[model samples]
Target: MASSMLKSAGEIQNLIFSQNQKLTHLARCGRIDEAVKLFESMPARNAVSWNCMISGLAKNGRVADARHLFDRMASKNLISWNTMIAGYSHNNRVLEASQLFDEMPKRDSYSWTLMISCYSRNGELERARWLFDSMPGVKTPVCYNAMIAGYAKNGMFQDAIVLLTEMPVSARNMVSWNSVLAGYTQNQEMVQGLKFFGEMQEKDVVSWNLMVEGFLQVGDLESAWSFFRATPCPNVASWVTMLNGFSKSGNIDEARRLFDEMPERNLVAWNAMISGYVQFLQIEEAYRLFGEMSERNSVTWTTMINGYIRIGKLEKARELLDSMPFKNVVAQTAMLTGYVQCMRMEEAVELFEKISTKDDFCWNAMISGYAHCGRMDKAVELYKRMPTKSLFSLNTIIAGHAQQGEMHKALEVFKQMRERNTVTWNSIISGLTQNGFYCDSIKHFVLLRNEGRKPDPCTYACGLAACAYLAALQVGKQLHLLLVKSGHVNDLFAGNALINMYARCGRISSAKQAFDEMASVDLISWNTLITGYALNGFGRETISLFKEMEVNGFRPDDITFVGVLSACSHAGLIDEGLKYFDSMSRDHSVERVAEHYACVVDLLGRAGRLEEAYKLVTEMPIKVNAGVWGALLGACRMHGNPDIAKFAAEKLFVIEPQKTSNYVLLSNVHADARRWEDVDRVRSLLKEIGIQKQPGCSWIDIKKKVCSFVSDDPMQPGATEVGFVLEMLCAHIRNTEIMPWSSLLDCG
Candidate 1:
């Protein structure tokens, strides 16, 4: 054919057709420059020729050059204008695209679509909506699909659903239906998403894939598998979603079986399996799968690197990272994040500097690393230098400040944040509670509710802790009801928090009821219940529960021992206290900390064994903290042993020099022993140091109002009537011969 064509000039004209075809091929392959050279070298050009070259240039992101070539065209068509507008929109030059959209001489449905897609992709929903509503002629389904997709992508599930429902039957297609379903799933409304899926008239492969993914997102593996089995021709996405779901749900065996049985596997499928093994800390399985991968992408290498990092094999992670053929930003970010998680901030920072192109995630990793390491100054310094800040960065900085007890700085960062998430509210509330600002924590919790940020288990746990510490029973019960209504009571963490609140409020029965109602109980649940019982002076019940804990295959932890020892000490069960204290390391393998020693010392002191308590404090292998000596001093006061009281008080002053309670307890001990001279000496020492004792106070919640009474409190409303009633109660108690009322009458 080439020989015959060479023999005739007419046949040689076929070179024009061949050359145009070459130009189209180059443009399609994203070689726009080559296409331009070919187009320029063409001996002649036609309208189809110019349109092909212009489309190639615009699609390849050469918008400016595409526009220049478009202007050079002697005659322009609607396709030319649409190409230019779409080029600008796709490149994120929305203003240029909008200007071109307004300037188009004759617009088609495709022309409107180009503009709508631009606004939708850019999250300019209002502009997209206006364009949709003001479309010059009848709207196309593609136009509606683009707008619905944008709403779904932006997490506006309700808006997307409204538009889907309002759409004409002619315009509602599979893509539109899938977009709404995906929107619900993305927003975590899995139940609604599933319901919508059930109502779909027709389901395609994409629809089935979305259903599988939606069920996986909600941790409903049985439903996810049901969809997976129903899929007519499962694509790579279908298999990968199920694999990932199984892995996340801790069904690693099922994930592996599906991975091995997949008819065809993509890079993402391989990564999902590797990630699943890593998530469960099955490093050996992950390693085997990594070696077996027929082909590997950057994700495969990075996944293994992260797997090693998660298992504390940082050296292995570094080795794999160094061996990577192409270290992309994602791989680098994974390693940086691994180092940050391991508390290796110095190494993370070193790697961060080595990254040639730093993304927001890289900067966030460095900031979060410094924050976790307790270097807030460095975190703030790096945060200020970030060229652009995301909500994640802002949240990390806020959490960093909260961790350091800098509530002011945390609040400042929070106020600066353009967006606040559940984590942001959690950080503030939890920080306030941890730093002993219970009322402030509760106040922020209310603000969180008012702001419409739904509280998760962590938020409710923090709020409940504040209630427990503040003894805000009314507020605590309200939150408890919220938990019950929200079904958060089924969560072990929230249930434990409920027990803690009830116990701290002296409602031991309520605490026990919560403990009994839990469907599943962890060691924390057992410890919380035990601690609550001990706090409310149910010593025998506390001991009985501890026995039950051991029988239930739950080993005692440090907190458990603290509660048990306190129960024994308060109830004068000296022998039981000694046995548990000695058995801490032997029976439970929990090494005794300072609090444990303090409990035992207090136990002995409260049992009238002053000499034994002092000897134990002096001879303990661990350092005697002020708490241990403080216990001994209080015991000396109880038993009227001024000599030992003086010794313990001296140790207390040195250990905690400014502790006013040390001096006061010593003075009280001397007064109990009728040693006026020693009491005077202690009082003079307190005056010399300019120390003042904080007055003890009590509070009661009456009709949801907390009324506080301090020593010698100023007369409040109805004080005279309350005093008269109290006097009558004291007289009745005295008349009734109640033994404990004598001390109360003497105080009145």
Candidate 2:
């Protein structure tokens, strides 16, 4: 190249930029060999020539070659530096990018922003923030947008919003608007996201895409489609975003329609459609798409396997996994979780052992599987034996412990964690409340505040559940006030929790107020309030509320059925209960579970139709668990029919002979038949085996401290007062149809 550059001006066979342009075209076309041949023929080379070659090399992933070419350049200008920096940044060479940035002859705002963006792309968020603070105030929108996008990507929505607020609107650009809109979407503030989006009249492609993405983020598929229709032109991104929103919104038919109509399909578009089917539990559609894809990447394969796993089509997931030409941690974890979640623990462990490498996500995925499947021991064992720990892994195992009623162990892990974030705290609190450590969870909630940490919605949700568990209206009110003061009253988790707490504590009006005041309600919010209404014997109100939820465009899930079916049973609406069961499958596409069938049995049994209840249980597709059989048996006992009661009891006993309720229910059936000999035999068998019921317990939280009391235990702080309160409540309920037994447990 230098030898050719020694030619005289008259000997120059080509114009300077003409030759450079040809070289750029060659490089851009990835004809590196021919580009080099042309480069060597150049009579002269300048900074632009070197930058072009550098960019080509970097773009082609020849970062070392690009670096060598950069170093060998005789003179470098600002363009040269920017070009090289962009190449390294694009190639993900963050350290080299930072080195180049530090050594640049002159640094402008683009230089600063580009470097910051490099860090952000690499997920070095703290490093990006450091660069952001060091930027000079000629600070362009690019720089702030980079910082905002960085924050948003890392889930620091508040930080992103705060910076967006402090920055002047005059400095706003499309990138800036996109970042803020995306930040709001990621934080689940779809309304505000749209507000910011609609406010952007001077929009570009990214601007329009951001708004569509915001609607998609909140499962507002109709709104997203409306926007997509209104757009003058839609890009691959817009089409895919709309399709994905539809898919996730449980409109797989709409998703397929959009996918089929796409004019041009990129890999992203392909992945989105595949992922959309999986999200909707349309496993056949997802797998069909996966098979139809002529060119499938890791994402497509991973999506198909995950969809199959979620739908309990583990065989299909394994087949896809085995057939995949490319396998990664995501696929491996998906398979492992499939087995673990389905309670095939041995198979999951066998697969896990065969994997050579496991990332933090892999560990967490496995832990999550075990936790969800109720194999807490295995989950705990794996967590202890994990070679590495991440915040995700720790939080997952902590949540698993909480799920399994291992509050003490969960707290131990929380206390031992090197890094404790909000999720960790939330998991611990949730576990405590879920495991019946209500007082302890409430104490931890106060302790969290005392430690200068503000509770997120999940935290308040757990605390509110604790209050409900304890039936503490006073404590619930205080937490409510605290939530209002903290300005998180609109949070779905907090609102739902407050509703449950107030309803359970006999403050139904307050609960309704909290529920009505909520700006946005999720499925859980509706379920909580509906269930509260049912528990309060407001069956008509429960049904009406459920109807309203659907009218407002919310889909009812399994939990919703529990409330509605329970309402039906309590109100003797046998016909209504059966209608809901049919609708659950026919209209809502919700599969009827044994619990649902059990609710139907309870409804029939309460109406004194033991034969109908028995027929329904026998016709159930899945195994009727003890709960279902027990309901039928209880109905038999109520009707004083020993034959049917014995039948239901035998089924329940085979499932769990050791369950005290099964024995107690059998005894009651026999006693109702005047089978005194059988009742005595049952009493002797229980005493001989030393099988005793676990005592009922209650606890309270006072000023961030836990105090516990059992029905017969006297070690609690306010044992005497608790005993007195229980006796008084018992006396008050003595004249009611139901008997009061301090030690008796309610299955609900």
Candidate 2 per-residue C-alpha lDDT over 121-190 given as tens digits, one digit per residue, 9 for 90 to 100: 7778899989888888778878888888888876677787788878889987667767877777776677
How large is the C-alpha RMSD of every model relative to the true structure?
9.4, 9.6
Model 1 segments beyond 4 Å from truth? 1-132, 135-162, 183-196, 205-233, 341-344, 483-495, 512-521, 547-553, 573-576, 615-619, 694-748
Off by over 4 Å in 2: 1-144, 148-177, 188-202, 219-223, 226-233, 283-288, 345-350, 353-356, 369-387, 449-457, 477-499, 510-531, 539-748
- lDDT per residue as tens, model 1, 31-137: 55567778998877776688888777767656667788888998888877887787778677788899988888889999888888899988889999998899988
**lDDT of all the models against the reference?**
0.84, 0.80
Strongest candidate by lDDT: 1
**TM-score of candidate 1 versus the correct structure, residues matched by position:** 0.75
